[model samples]
Target: MDNKPLSFKGLRLLVVDDDPDTRKLISILFELDGAEVLTATSASEALEIILCFQPDVLICDICLPDEDGYSLLRKVKRLDIEQGRITRAIALSAYVMDEDRQYAYLAGYQKYLHKPINLDELAKAVNDLAQLQQYA
Candidate 1:
């Protein structure tokens, strides 16, 4: 086995999705890229982890139990500003409407991913978000 660590080693990723399968799959995907991944099944759960983990990147589904992804995104941005922390975010959903994508970006997501997502795209998003953090 190669002893070298993966590119994302030590990076923290928080994935918020109400679907267990989706959450697990994304967590595994990020882990494979060497990130420490945290999964939440609801927006409230995600908020809790966001406060505690202070993840390097957030991958969030647009639909959630208590609130939608846009609401969650707003909460995250408010939390970061209140606490003086800056974090990058990616919005993931199956919506795929022009307005949906626009809403995500307007709510502060740096990038958007349509669901039934490609593993390669997810990996690249994580890497890109991490790189963005370095420059932010």
Candidate 2:
């Protein structure tokens, strides 16, 4: 577990997962770290939130209730490109297979994380994305 306290004071984050517990856990973690977090229980809701929130980073589960994370990310990517917004995404899944990871990258996720997520690592990843955005 990484103990480093990440600084994400003003970063906006969206967490999409069908499991309410997962969403709540991630939301709490990010909020504790100073990130403004929004959560969606399904892919469709996620898309709607994306349009309105325009979050800086999105952490999504691979297996969603309505649509898969790959499909969600693809749509999000299209919307981002169309609107000229840069929103980096991360794929979170219980599947740790190489094929799954590869597919996530092909679908436009910048990072892939397995479930039973380490909150510290997630914070670091979000912080890193925020830093990268600053450089970009």
Candidate 3:
């Protein structure tokens, strides 16, 4: 096993999903790894939290209650550019279609995570985004 220790401390991550169960699971995973996790069940709430937290990374579900993740991501991109907040974002969704992945990239997600996310992958994405933020 490549046992490189993972430290999620000091990383602020936002988990946006309408599914409570998935949100809870992902939140727990991130918390277990020592990250500051924020949850938003709706796009409006997410926008509010995003404004306040300005998280280092975003892990958003592609399908939301009010709006799709792409729309929200576009808003985030605008905010990031306008406010100079370069937070790296990732798309978390069950849709694993190649077109979906392409759309996510086009929508500005730095990474795309499948629904049943591997914990290791999730952790790595957070760490990588944190590093990218540090460098940015």
Candidate 4:
């Protein structure tokens, strides 16, 4: 494991989760890593934020009160594609089944993470995805 701190300076991130504690924890983690973090409790709120926030990455839970993460990822993909933007997304969920992982990939997530999440791994994954985007 890399002990170097994740550098997310100037990057914008959106974290969507119905659980307030989850949201706060993730937000603090990213913020501490130097990313500007935004939180949304539902898919609808996330979609609305995406329009203006134009985040570099989205970390979202699969389950929500309004809509599922898969649906939200689809919409975000479509919107970003049409707008000519590259916004990578990660599926952060409690569903760790093989089928769930497959479905998440099919739904267009760049990464899949299961809760309770390992913050170090999450940082590494996000950093890796951001690096990929830079090359893309």
Candidate 2 lDDT for residue 19: 90
- Please report, as a residue range, the 10-residue window in candidate 3 with the lowest summed lDDT: 1-10
Inter-residue clash pairs, candidate 4: none
TM-score of each: 0.92, 0.93, 0.93, 0.94
Candidate 4 at residue 22, lDDT?
90
Candidate 2 vs. true structure, TM-score:
0.93
How far does residue 13 in candidate 1 sit from its true spot (Å)? Answer: 0.5
lDDT of 2 by residue, 1-136 (tens): 6566677778899999999899999988878768899999999999999988999999999999888999999899899889988889889999989999999999888888898998867777787788887876
Per-residue C-alpha lDDT of model 3 across residues 1-136, encoded as one tens digit per residue: 6578878877899999998998898889878878899999977889999998998899999999899999999998898998987979989989999999999999999999997878789888877788889999
Those runs of model 4 whose alpha carbons end farther than 4 Å from true positions after fitting are 1-4
On TM-score, the leading prediction is 4
Candidate 3 has an lDDT of: 0.89
- TM-score (C-alpha) between model 1 and the true structure: 0.92
* Model 1 Cα lDDT, one tens digit per residue, 104-126: 99999999999898877888777
Q: Rate the local accuracy (lDDT) of all candidates.
A: 0.87, 0.89, 0.89, 0.91
Query: What is the per-residue lDDT of model 4 for residues 5-121, given as tens digits with 9 covering 90 to 100?
Result: 679988889999999999999889888868999999999999999999999889999999998999999999899889998888899989889999999999999899999989887
Candidate 2 has which clashing residue pairs, if any? none
The model with the greater lDDT, 1 or 3, is 3
Error of 3 at 117 (Å): 1.8
C-alpha RMSD of candidate 1 = 3.6
